[model samples]
Target chain A: MVKLTLNVVMAERNISSQELAKAIGITPANLSILKTGKAKAIRFSTLSKICHVLECQPGDILKYVDE
Target chain B: MSKWLKIGINVLIMFLRFGIVAGYFMLIYPIIYLADAFQNHTTHAILNGSDFLRFSNNQQATLGAVKRFPSWPYALIMSVGVVLTVWATIKLLKALIKLLSNIRDQNYFSTSNELALITIIKAQVMMLLGDLLFASGNQLSQSWLLRVNTGVFSETWETCFHDVFQIIMLAAIYETYRHAMRVKAENDLTV
Candidate 1:
């Protein structure tokens, strides 16, 4: 399964969810959905914005895991 | 989905609710009257010899009062049929009103709405069956049991065709709604 490691990246970057959501111009609820791995799909623009705000590559926040 | 559309749906729901209540009362009126007439043993009650249980009266009274009185069993069956028809109609209308209310609130693409549509379909089926049973009973009693005129057969077909068409339309709407809900759920889950 494709899993999001957004919480770990946010912790390492010392960035709160509210701050990252505001920086990426997305709602906190949507950010929470992504963080909780409940999102079905993420837009390329949203991923780009998140990567830019966190100062990290997409791989840093995403991972694949077998269930 | 639009503001004006929502307002229009709201008005339609209000009108629908009123109509449902009024129609329910009108439908049950005959049942109530039959029960009262039976209770008082009034000769005013006309059964038209449609009794599934009785075949004594073969004479079809086309217009006014006949020499024979309506048996209690026939009256009971007629009352039960009327009550069932009224009950199914009320349930259908109630489900419709709930669906309309949800639409007015822009709360479409929900499980509750789907269930409501299913309920409406079920109620429609019940009503259609009840109507068919009543019509067939009348026609059969006239032709086979009482052996009177069989003119009601044509009327039965006309009514059943209309009901069948309505059921088909409702089923189509249900399928479309089900597809829309699936798409909406997928879109909602997509971040």
Candidate 2:
């Protein structure tokens, strides 16, 4: 299963949901959807925005969890 | 799914609104009859026919007895039948309208779709119960008024069976909607 670690990265970066949403040009609702792993897919552009804002590699925000 | 087909359904629903008005008007007559019967202590000859109303060999002898009996109960039953039918028609039209709007919004899979099917089931159930009451009233009165008001008992009973069949069909559609909603949820959650 693909587990999102975006919440963890956000925590490490000390970025609030509202701040992240503003930085990524997304609504807080959508940012919450991603942080909670409810998003179906993340566009590369969105991922790039998050990476640029947090200064983290894509792998730092995603992980494969074997179940 | 065609434009004309959608419009046709809408027109049918519009006619049903007219029917509801007719039903409301029809509903008043029985109450008036009941009032007249109670006030005068003798009802107007609302209906008198055993032959055309199809009295059984057993019930043929009961015609004299039916006339001697008070007519208020039959009137009350008739009113109940009309009320149930009108209620069912209203529910059915509401469901159809909701379904049309859902289709218009491309909401093929959702709880609202299932709700429409459920409304149809409820309408059918109400009609079936109304048919039962009408059948019972028919047994008591066997009047031409009943025949004119609510058609044949056996026919409406058969129609109740058809409504049951329709309920089954709607249940199948409801199940399909449930499955479609699940698939939609899965798709929305997939990465």
Candidate 3:
């Protein structure tokens, strides 16, 4: 399964969830969904925005894991 | 759903409910007459006196014709079945109306809409069971009592098949809606 490591990236960058959510122009609840791996899919544009806001590559926030 | 579409569907549901109530009254009228005449010695005269409704011999009776007087208990049971069938059909229509209203409000996949669909399926099942029980009781009563085939005993297998078909169709719709609800939830959760 594809899992998000957004928390680890945010923690390393000293960014709060609210800061990242607001920076990426998404609601905090939606960011929580991504952070908790509850999201079924992510749009390319949103991913790009998140990557830009977090100053990281897509791979830094996303990881595939065997379930 | 479009505003007009919702309005149209709601209107149709109300119309269907009205028809069910009217048909229920029609079915119950004979029972009411029979009950009223049960105390009188002229039960036969009162039943046969009506120009629009007359019971004839089994030989002269067609599918639409009423033949012979069912026992009072048989008639009562048949009336109960008709009541149940009509009640369930009306409930089913009500559920559909609720579902349509939910769709009109852009509340597709809401729990209330799912419950409404479930209610629709349950009502269809109730209708099927009520009809089948009525049919079976009619047969049993005919065999046990005066052997007079009255009331809905004359209903063909096609009617039973139609009821079963409707139940199956509603079940299919319920399943499809369930699938769609899951898809909608997944879509909603996606970022």
Candidate 4:
């Protein structure tokens, strides 16, 4: 199963959703959704954008946890 | 009016536009076929006998039966539909963008609004992409460079993309609704 753990990273880095949104050229609402793992799928471009802004990797934000 | 009411109106407007387009095509198709048939019949009749009165009457009837003014109503309806759809789409997109921006800027760490905003954005993107694909497919047959295979492939790709996008959008929407329900429950408890 695909699992995302962005919340933990955000907490660890003390990154606000707004900052992440601005940096990634997306709205904070989108960032918030991503943070909560409520998003069904992530655009590769958007994922790249987020990673670029958050100074993280895809693996850092997402993980494959057993369902 | 409420936001949901506005959305309903927008949907009705879209349906009206679709009906108008269908009606236009239905009206024009038989006329085109009849025109071709009449032209062929006239050519054959002229070869046999030059009955000027009958020929003139036929021409007059065809011209009179063409229904010129009906096009105006269709044009007007189509124009209005296009404007309404465009306006609604823009308004929704702007609202989504603004809400997302606000949520991010305000640094609201709560999950509910964030999830809703994300779902909204995904929905907008899917809608935009679907519209684009539809418009592109509509034009594909008109292009000289486009082959039947290419057109078919493009259409298939468009369908696949639209389906996948919709599925993702629906999933996001479900997640948002779940979060909203949870948030509402928490708020009720607090109150």
The segments of candidate 2 whose C-alpha lies over 4 angstroms from its true place after superposition are A7-32, A39-67, B1-6, B32-52, B55-64, B68-70, B142-156
Give lDDT tens digits, candidate 2, residues B114-179. 888888888988988877767666655445333332443333456667877877887887788788
The full ranking of all candidates by lDDT, starting with the best, is 1, 2, 3, 4
DockQ of each: 0.70, 0.30, 0.84, 0.03
State the weakest 10-residue window (summed lDDT) of model 3 chain B. Answer: B46-55
True contacts kept of 3: 0.81
Candidate 4, B1-191: lDDT as tens digits: 45665566566556656655554444443343245344544223222332212322233323333322233332333233334334434544544444444444553444545554565555555444544443443333213212222321123346546656766775777676667767765543320
Ranking by DockQ: 3, 1, 2, 4
Which runs of model 3 end up more than 4 angstroms from their true locations? B1-3, B6-70, B133-155
DockQ of 2: 0.30
**Every candidate's chain B TM-score:** 0.66, 0.71, 0.67, 0.32
lDDT of 3 by residue, B67-136 (tens): 3344454556556666677778777777777876776677877888889888987887777766775676
Ranking by TM-score: 3, 1, 2, 4
Error of 3 at B152 (Å): 9.4
* Candidate 1 CAPRI classification by DockQ: medium
Instruction: Name the docking class for model 4.
Output: incorrect
Report how far residue B138 has shifted in candidate 3, in Å. Answer: 6.6
RMSD list, candidates in order? 5.9, 5.8, 5.2, 18.4
Candidate 1 per-residue lDDT over residues A1-67, each given as its tens digit: 9999999999999999999989999889999999998998989999999899889999998998998
Instruction: Please give, as one word, the docking class of candidate 3.
Output: high
Write the residue-wise lDDT of candidate 2 on A1-67 in tens digits.
8878988888888988899999889888878778888887778898899899999999999899998
